[model samples]
Target: MDTKLLQEIEKGTKSALIKKNIINYYIQSGSSTITELSKVLDLSIPTVTKLIAEMCDDGYIEDKGKLETSGGRHPSLYGLNPESGFFIGVDIKHFRVHIGIMNFKGDLIDEDLIPYSIENSPESLDHLCKIILSFIHKQNIKQDKILNININISGRVNPESGYSYSIFYFEERPLSEIISSKIGYRVTIDNDTRSMTYGEYLAGCVNNEKNIIFVNVSWGLAIGIIIDGKIYSGKSGFSGEFGHIQAFDNEILCHCGKKGCLETEASGAAIYRHLKQAIKDGASSILSKKILEGKHITLQDIIEATNKEDILCIELVERTGLELGKHIAGLINIFNPEMVIIGGTVSLTADYIMQPIKTAIRKYSLNLVNKDSKIVLSNLRDRGGMIGACLLARTRLFEI
Candidate 1:
């Protein structure tokens, strides 16, 4: 949020805090009658009634129709105004960006993708800012109506301090602050994997499953954790760096400059590397001809071949899934979560990716612990990060 806004919120009194509570309540419960809200918020009826009037006058909330009552007078419902504010959620990849806008009610209103390549440099950072502003202009969204811009980026990001350790590193100011200056809007940045996890938790399947783990098997690998029904960002918001854990004894270097990391053997990068090598070793498959020609291979191409029953592709995919599951089984032993969600580009392979992971879990994890957790694929799939960023923007807005 802006500095002035933060100052106001911090200096505000008890009534201000209660107003925040009311906004958060509507966000969580959709809509509620004054009587219901008073009971839930532990406030007097007159107090809630007055606050409701103030919020309505301030254009933050609105009065919906009354709820039907059998005998006594029907109670009117108050809820957030859907158009009171808007949020921009950006999912940034190395070479792609997904931009979307969401209403205050957490509904995605518009989404678009841009082929914007980003590297760890000042120029790339400025390029991202231009793209965001351009998107807003193209959509004709008023700057005043936009509440904040929330970005989901891959790598080591400490969301609390708004500093990104992996990309656009700076010494003086946090990345979010830098971007905010360029775009003239409040900016919030978080780990992409964590945002994807939140997206699935809020909008995907697995209804009300509190303790959860969302495994993102993309070009690289990472995880998002939900503990006690809240997104678990550890000391520096780096709690779910699942891919960097050492799981093998090898010399292959990972993107993080470490050897023997799980990412070196089980990520989308692993599948691509293994598939290409297998094809070079006289393995016959749909991707073999492309491999023989020394053409670039993408994870999507490999997944398509696997879905078409290519033997080499299938083996490579299953190997990745099996390795992922073996490691995930250890997590089950530790966390005993209620659900584990598999997501990202690799998940598009569907059964080719899921079956092997399921097998490894059944064979490796304790039956008792594994039984408490149901492992499944993400319902949001490729859209998780984008949608999650939008939801993140909405939820963080009321944190003041």
Candidate 2:
């Protein structure tokens, strides 16, 4: 190897070692006092103190406050500084953008929403950029202080470059660069479902659990696989594209230009669409009048209908649940994850959804895996996307 290459390699090794110790200290104690970190990292007090002082000077950590002392004086507590830097997480949905901010410890500081239609044209990108800039300005956070930005989009994101083959009609641009240019931060973009899984592992459902799967069942179905507390984006970062999985022999067209996809029959958007058609076909539902009034139908509507014992609505939700359950069963057989965290708008009706999913897993998945695996709704619910984006911002970049 070249002499310069050798020197650069050595520098890289030292940088990793330093970052590793800092990350280890943060992970072990959640937040660490400088003295505690120095001792834990096994360096001499003075040397450790110097390193910490440098870190503080670099805005990686800060002196939070003093701990109360019984005698003499109080000891200052040093921790990963919340204000030293910020991260932005944006979940780009079919209808809305859910954005949130997080500090180093993955604590959500604030969130906002912006709605837009999925026309997928040049105008849509302009609209998205405007919404993001407006949100950043409204928060009053310094753009320079923003270290990382994570964006989740609804289509396949080329993991190597952050380019997307989109369903919506927008100018094709690398999402990471687009956001980075506007926000002046290092931006990471991934598939929405993968981000949800990453979020569950970092803050919500699978925080302590090592093996978990986050299933996103909204306008489309997607899976986020966490194996041993890490998001498992297999070859091409498209490993968990669950929506296109064949679920029926029926001739229903799917968004992916396929037929009989699980998403066509079971996703929240499907439920809303199915209910509208059912009512038009003289199906009896209390929601019928609401639909006639031009009220927007959501997953909540079907759930509420089930609560009121509306036969058609109940059947609709139950059937969707049954299809979802079968798909989950296939996941259980393949991944054998310890927990299956169901997320998305549809998961608000977890009680009704879980029944059929559980039944299907018991019927189709291998007994060995299904016996210990659990299927539950995400604790974060609506917050998974944003929280996941926050965690995604925190993730160390993988080098090939």
Candidate 3:
């Protein structure tokens, strides 16, 4: 190698080390006082001060005024600049796609959702690309000012390659590469359930605990596992495919071409199926009107029906919860996670579902694992997947 190039590499290496330390401090403190950052980073006050000043000059961070003083000068607070660069989060669901934009603080500055389907093989990606491109154009932000684009998708993913195994229409064309190349920014893609779990970890959930499981109860069931603050993508990039685990010996078929899978018996799709049959059998509820109208029954319809004290819907949800809890108890036994986070539209039935879930777990799980683990709802809702994408991109920027 040329000596000049070698010298530049050394200089870059040193700079990256300093930046990594500073970034770690910022992420740990959430937002830090300069003195605090300096102390945590173990640097002289002046050296740390100058480094922060330089980062501010480069538009990476900003002074956010002062902290409380205790008969002393108020120390200044510093935070990642909200306007420095924007990150876009796109969540592709079974029925729709939600797009969100945020600055470094992860606050939602803008968001919109539109109906989307994978039925059309060629047009799906085209439509998705158009939606994102149009969103950026309408915002009037320079393309170069966008730092990263993050996408969350429902289904199996090859985490190492950022490829979706189920979104085969985009096969041979990695979605991340396509988006990044077209939009002139870094792009990230991951399984939606896992993304949401990562978002909870970043938000300091589980008392900042490390091992966590985020279970998404949606049209299909899925789980995201985080070990030591990182996603545990197993061999062949397949881990936590809990939905396909056998939950029953019945004849119900699952989308993954399996019979008696957990999702076939316990997912939002399963709940919808039960409600449709009950309504067909003359069960009475406001949803019966929708059934009479020949309209599609959604997870929301079941949730509302249960909330209205519809006996059949309540029974169905309780049964589903019991099935889910059994699956969860198995996970608790195996992983012994510190926390299990439940998320998705089905959690709307959490009130009707939680007790039965706990009942099943208490009935099956080992006392020790069950004792230390707490099951909770995701704080970020559907937004967790998108936020996790941003964290995915942000971590890359600061990682070794």
Candidate 4:
């Protein structure tokens, strides 16, 4: 082919891909009219109408009745064929792995949870792979119909290269590539905090917010930054290590080999450690019974104790909340985000945790910045990372 002709063909192919992506976006966002899609996709109404008509004829989309309008005629709404394809999202945490399966229309089909410590076993990856395979088999979905697998892990991840800095013992090969080869599927990987941030952007508390911060305060603390309506994975995809920021001069060592890091003071692990130490020091509390009974007191136990207004649990949570809030206040001053969402299992405590955080924000952050930023609890909670993994797969599969 002539060079000019080849260039023309490439351009046409790119345009078609973009149009198809628009269709996928509409599908994921639920039913919408051509006018709405055109506006969202930045395409002309005539072009959107033509593409929608083609998709309808191809059985990829169908008229889903009409949407009520203010004054004009009801607009015809189009939605995707639910049976078109499937997606899987896997969230690999320190102590558990969560899997979620969804269809083309973004409806969650099924989910599974497997509890296993990644740090304790060398064969954790093999076990995880087996569980994933078993879960897929249980879904009764064909392998070919599954578009992609998205995995979110806690660490610095290069989404494009599929390598994680803090996982799989930093092995020679990229984790995503290895998993894809084993599972016989295309795979994408990302940092768990970033994934949860994107999840909130798509379907949680930070929806439609251009500038936002999502803080995950589980076993550890991490923050996800969103700038200009997109996840801001800084150079080397390691931007959101908020937990490692220096908070105190105490000799307490952090897991990252640092002393007095924010995570050492404010994370769920930190809270558990402090509570255990206090119990060892003969401090009286509800959790002391568990410790005396030779049972390890978990973060959940502390949260439940706080619910019952136990003095020790209440005080410890408040202290951790204050520490976390101080760090978040610093983030607010530096990033000037429109919103900050506190997520993870700890956030379930509601006012007990949030009250102290709010107070600390007021005391530490600049009045102008703190007053404008809305700090709220995440609606997605622990599921944000898994949902985000599915969204990541959908975005890549449809090029949306």
Candidate 5:
């Protein structure tokens, strides 16, 4: 074997790798004693102590008092100083963008929401860059302290090359490189669904689950698959296009240029469109009154109406939920995931949606698969994508 290949196999010098691992372990575990670090890193006590001393001197890690030992002297606990670094996580949607600034411990320090539509053109790119720069400037933090920027957007993203095939049309440059060059910080981009799934896996309800599926039910539906304890982005990093899966044989066209896709009948956009059509057809409901008052019915309006037990809204939500559940049942039969996390804005209507989804899953999925899979609402809610983006940035920059 070549010497270069051997070096690659070793990752780096032993000391450098050990230091990196130590930092990552401290970040993940919150704090660690010298003996604990030594055991986890499989290094000598003296070696671990030396590296910890160096890190403490360099202002990376700090002694966080001591941990009570069973018998001997108390062991000093070392943790990453919260001020050591910062990360920015951006969650982009078609009509809005959410930016979160997180500390080294992954706690969100600050956040900003920009209500702006992102167009699929260069002008939009310039506007996005400006928005990001403005947000960072307003945080009153040094640019160097902001270590990494993780961006999560809804689309088919090629993680390796940072090419977003679903959104920007800049054929000549990768989106990550373009954003990084303009923002003056390293950037990493991922699909919004995948990022949310990763966030759940890291800190939400799906923590430590080896096999899990996160279904994001928003304006559109998307799935994030975790197999064997890692995100499965498939060959092109576009694995979870669950929204586009065929759910009906009807002629309703989808944004993906297909007819009868799951999103066509089961997404928030679909529910809104269907409600509008029903009102136009003289359907009697409270939403119709809102329509008469020249107010457009949004997904939120429908959810509110459903809570009020308005027949039309209740029917619409249940129908959409059933359609979504059918697709989810198919997924359960295939993946046999330990957990199915339902997230996104639409998930807020948990009372109206969960039961229908459960009904459909029971009806369509095999007994064994349906019984084993636990479908639950996401705890992180809207923050999952942004949190996941921050985690992505940390993992990429720190190789954690």
Candidate 6:
């Protein structure tokens, strides 16, 4: 399982680039006959054969028995050796972290969730680094085989520079570089919403729809936009701040220090605040006793309450969904995406939120444009972020 061989590929060699293309093809299309590879990679038969043989000997690619055929001889198939490389994806949230492991073939082989806190302090970053290293050590694989790590943190992350401007933003050097140095591995940093969007696009319900939007309704609100089959990062990689668009007239100050932002009404933080105020105003619901006892309620508890048929919780969640959809209708009039995915911690409440979101979109957006967009829930649920991190790490590492 040595893809350190990849690190040695010379920058300018024709054969070196061809070999990378072959591997990339397998990653995207799975196993294929050399004949198919020759045609797809646009190399002569002899060249494809020679390189395929060399890759086999170098342990970069391996022989699968043959492609199934009806009558004639089955063509021999070649594909990447999944053991050659591994990737780790970590999705860090406010009080928990999810770690996932993926092999070279783009399969999520294993995953885990651990309770943790993310904060803007050197000590917090140090803890994040140590926990990642510890998690790696606990897995039953060679450390060198784990070629890269991708960390998905909530905030403004310039993936090109690996700098997070919000969570764990207490450093001059790139956070990816810091974690890489500590863990002794190549690392990439990504935005949590973007990572989750990638997860939903590749592993969720997205299928051939090039234009899509993923709205994350979590502790905060943001979006992941895919345009023409690629994630749209805008001009400065700071796109998808969907919740910050000015939409209200009230003086509800957002944590971003802005007033009348949609997040002040639609995010998990907003829900928590509103729910507490409702209870304080003597509204009785399933959580009334807990609220009276001063027990802290989490987004997860609200989701659970909705599932338990709590009337007040369901109403608040629907209100958030309606607010979110109202803003998304404006997006539809602009981008007219084929699909809009409702995800994040609050999304686990399922249709308790989605119905209102869809209702708002239909009510506000143009009928022609809104009908073109299909609203759905994330199939991967809360798992999208970590899985997306692994994908980002794997594919981006291949670019290098």
Name the best candidate (by lDDT).
Answer: 1
Tens digit per residue, CA lDDT, model 3, 1-400: 1123123334677754786677656755668887788778788898888878877877777898888877778888998776776778787777778787876665667888777774536577778888788787877566666766778777777755878777744557777787677666677777777767777788635577888988888888999888886788787667778899876898987888889898988988998887888778888777888887898766766777788888888888899899999889999999998888888778777678888888999999999889999988777776776677666556545554
Residues 1-400 of candidate 4 have per-residue lDDT tens digits of 1123123334667555755676557744778888888888888998889877766665557789989879879889888866667889999765678899988778789998888667624377778888788888888876667878998888678887788877665468888888888878778888888888888888787656799999998888899998998778887788799889888888988888889898888988888888888988999898898886779656777888889998998898899899889889899999998999998768878888899999999999999888889999988987988998887777665552
Could you estimate the TM-score for every candidate? 0.95, 0.85, 0.87, 0.89, 0.90, 0.94
lDDT of 2 by residue, 1-400 (tens): 1123223334677644654567545633566566677677776767767766766766666777887779987777776666666778888876778998887666788898777665667667667778777777877766666666788888687655777776432446676777667656677888888888777776675546788888888778888887775568887777787888887897988878889888888888788888899888888788999887788765656766777778887677778888888878888888888898888877777677778878887888889889888888888887788888877766543121
Per-residue error for 58 in candidate 5, Å, reads 3.4
Against the true structure, candidate 6 reaches a TM-score of 0.94
CA-lDDT, candidates in order: 0.87, 0.74, 0.76, 0.81, 0.82, 0.86
lDDT of 3: 0.76
lDDT of model 2 at residue 128? Answer: 73
Candidate 4's displacement at residue 202, Å, is 1.6
Q: Candidate 5 lDDT (Cα, whole model)?
A: 0.82
State which candidate, 2 or 3, has the greater TM-score. 3
Give the range where candidate 6 is weakest over 10 consecutive residues by summed lDDT. Answer: 3-12
Off by over 4 Å in 3: 1-12, 42-50, 66-75, 182-184, 204-206
Q: Per-residue lDDT of 1-400 in model 1, one digit per residue for the tens?
A: 1233334456886777888888888876789999899999999999999988877877778888988878888888889888888989999864588999998778888998898777888888888998899889877666778988899988899988999988888667998999999999999999999999989988897697889999999989999999998888999888898999998899999989999999999988998888877778777889788789988766778878888898888888899999999999999999999999999889998898899999999999999999989999999988899999988888777764
lDDT of 6 by residue, 16-39 (tens): 777877876786678999899899
Clashes of 6: 0
Question: Can you give the lDDT of residue 82 in candidate 2?
Answer: 63
* Residue 21 local lDDT, model 4: 71
